[model samples]
Target chain A: MTAVPNGHDGLITARGLYLSFGAIPALVDVDIDLWPGEVLAVVGESGSGKTTLLNVLSGRVAPDAGAVLYTDPEGEQHDVHTMPAPALRTLHRSDWGFVHQDPKQNLRMNVSAGGNVGERLMARGARHYGTIRAEAIDWLTQVEIDADRVDDLPRTFSGGMLQRLQIARTLVTHPRLVFMDEPTGGLDVSVQARLLDLIRTLVARLGIAAVLVTHDIAVARLLAHRIAVMQRGRVVETGLTDQVLDDPQHAYTQLLVSSVLQV
Target chain B: MIRTEGLAKTFTLHLRGGMQLPVFSGIDLTVHSGECVVLSGPSGAGKSTLMRSLYGNYRAGAGHIWIRHHGGMVDIAASEPRIVLAVRRETLVYVSQFLRVVPRVSTLDIVADEPITRGIAPDEARDMAGSLLLRLNIPRRMHGIPPATFSGGEQQRVNVARGFIAAHPILLLDEPTASLDAENRSVVVGMIQEAKARGTAVVAICHDADVRAAIADRLYPLSPAREAA
Candidate 1:
């Protein structure tokens, strides 16, 4: 596990971010700042532009306005929107990991678990399968997935197991920042609890900053340090998780907090 | 209502030397109307296989499945393939964890296809699809877009909408909320609960404890010993 860097300040800063799907504006003038070694939960109802914001941040979708300024490990700041292709690729390879809501969509269903974890390493030019397999096994163990299943294809894994595999695959490369969209969304309560525990431990041990997009307030309360509440394509509230969740100021936030069914 | 008598499925795996591998055997389960049952187990415990077998996705090697429908109780094992197909098309709905939208199909059309195929009027089917999307909080404009480009969560919602568009009495869901966030999970769960209240016999294979606790009236744990035969 990598140590959280001391005095690691803002790593990513987005100002006046705007995104649209054709003519329908998904996000409008959103601003966010993420520091190293902290978890920031982006919470919102469905169709609230929470995912659009993540897409812009991850470089999968470009913003229509404003700038996404990211600071690399070497302390160089680059405008993410206008960065050169090679530089962007390097940033993606060395600095960022993304976990989508559906593990099957993010994972290569036809390949072995080890192959998925080793893909990032292979992309960065690691050729020896022996070394890659070793690393993959280590990562699988780290994520609490059974190492014996390393040779099994993802199609055979259960939903919770698949999510864990996806996490191991993304984090094996040791990226500085990770973005997870609904990491524990559909998991059984036991599985959700286990996955959340694993994520909390891994993030703390590695000191990797993360942006987690979730609709579950409990998840945000458990894993996030700071929470940003979004609604109708805008940030309605932003504060510490406990404060935002327990004492939400906006009507939407209040409704979300109140709507949570205690099980 | 549905009942299984020592229901068993075993796949004969032909290895390089033609050796066979037994997948599962001698499984018994039942699902009653107005009830939601969750089947959970470790990965590769044959949860999906069992769910698929209920809808006849996999032909059982042995045992019998008796489905009690409005028409009558029919032995699924002894029924003709065409009869099973007709029953599945009209009365049973299966939602796989991964969205399986056909290429070039619009979201609206995907949801409306099953009902239309089953002879529901096109306009009524479209209305049903639209209402389902609205209930699930999917934006109205997205109805016309092809599901191919939608995000993972969005596509899953479309898939769920399509699966239940006809309000089939028997619904099988394999991790229906696997791609949903917390809010959407609740919405989908509520929808499922509504279906159960409407007397739909639902068997959901899930790994989420929260979902199971929220919706399942009964639970079954698939054992590895049972899966390995």
Candidate 2:
């Protein structure tokens, strides 16, 4: 009950959030806040509810009890549990972007590179063909894609390029928050470095508040402004990125940090 | 909050038979929550254009202008107008150099309307607007008067008051203190600091060196695109 911080400028606040998969609990009285313009990394071993917290915060999964309050850009707080379906849909479409672990799962591989980016614009109601095409070119270039490959299908692209395109597609609308789950999980080390650099650059440049879920503490150390260390479906420690990584307070946190060091 | 990557903007002079004029390009910057970023550079270098692009007022020639609005990182350069409008309404709050008000609306009403639209009670909204106006030192007598007859500084104060009332996640200010006197400018600086402490991300343009130095966490110089290194 006393775990959640008080007087925080939370962009998204969860209070007593509880969820379960059948009889087994997924989240137990969890409380956290997604602050504005700061990357709050949820790091833990697998099955620690890092991804589950992400899903709950993003409104992709419903909790059995407790409430999640989301502050819209206009500063009005809405209860996520009872928010209207259309409003929730609009929130998903306009205010949030998700970068999944696999690019193929997020990208329309049969579509051309430009089409993947432009499709988001169309979803937002862009009708003029020329404007959409121009924006697609602009976004493609932003994500480091050559404009000449605008018409090339994503299926033809390499793994890293596909991830970049997926980022372009998700970010083109300038959503208020971004949810990323293991964005660089499967890439080669070199590719992961490059992609992580790009993601770091994009996240910083957009000032987009992010809730990044990762098991890799290195990734968390590299990009997160703050860290929320999860264990047994509960947050065992949370603090500024460097502080939590360097001088961990909780027993679980020290173990987690030391484990990363050992490797 | 706002982020950019290799963001570029240019103007096509159709009157000059489509003579392409490069304003600035290859720009990359980020303004974080509770942080104030001041856009600087010489005039005509597209400092305001960059701010405008973040607000979705101008289309970018190249690169991405990502804004966190509603719940997502939206690319303002490419998102549809409806999506941009939604972001503008809720997430990105912009204060232009001048005030634009509906005809015949009282200054109080104009300022009060923002919070009201955001679902605050009408009376409560008016009270908030009144206090903000008073903080900016607007005369109580003129609260009912239209801002059309106010001086440049007075109008600007009203505009600022209206913008600050929302406490939106991202704030874009264009020459916020251009018309204010020293005292009023100091008040504005304080207001900006308060906004930042509340976790509002701010990107603003200011010609005044003192004001820029006081509020800026960092300076983003928008040099001309032709000089790209």
For residues B17-64, what per-residue lDDT tens digits would candidate 1 score against the true structure? 333435567777888888998987788877887887787766666888
Per-residue alpha-carbon lDDT of model 2 for A1-263, expressed as tens digits?
Answer: 13345333578888888888887788987888777777889998999898999988888899888888888877888887799988988888788889999999889988899999999989899999999999999988988899999999998898888999999999999887999999989888767866776787678678798999999888887788778888888887776665567546567776787776542
Lowest lDDT sum, 10 consecutive residues, model 1 chain B, at B12-21
Cα misplacement distance, residue B227 of candidate 1 (Å) = 66
Which prediction has the highest lDDT against the true structure? 2
| Worst window of 10 by summed lDDT in candidate 1 chain A | A1-10
Instruction: Provide the TM-score, chain A, model 2.
Output: 0.94
Query: How many pairs collide in each candidate, listed in order?
Result: 7, 27
User: What DockQ would candidate 2 receive versus the native complex?
Assistant: 0.01
DockQ, all models: 0.01, 0.01
Which regions of candidate 1 are displaced past 4 Å?
A1-8, B1-229
Please state the error at residue B39 of candidate 1 in Å: 52
lDDT of 2 by residue, B1-229 (tens): 6889998876654444546678887888988889999988998878887887777666677899988876778998776443565687799888999776544568998898878767788899999999999999998999999898999999999999999998898999999999999999999999999999999998999999999998999988776667323
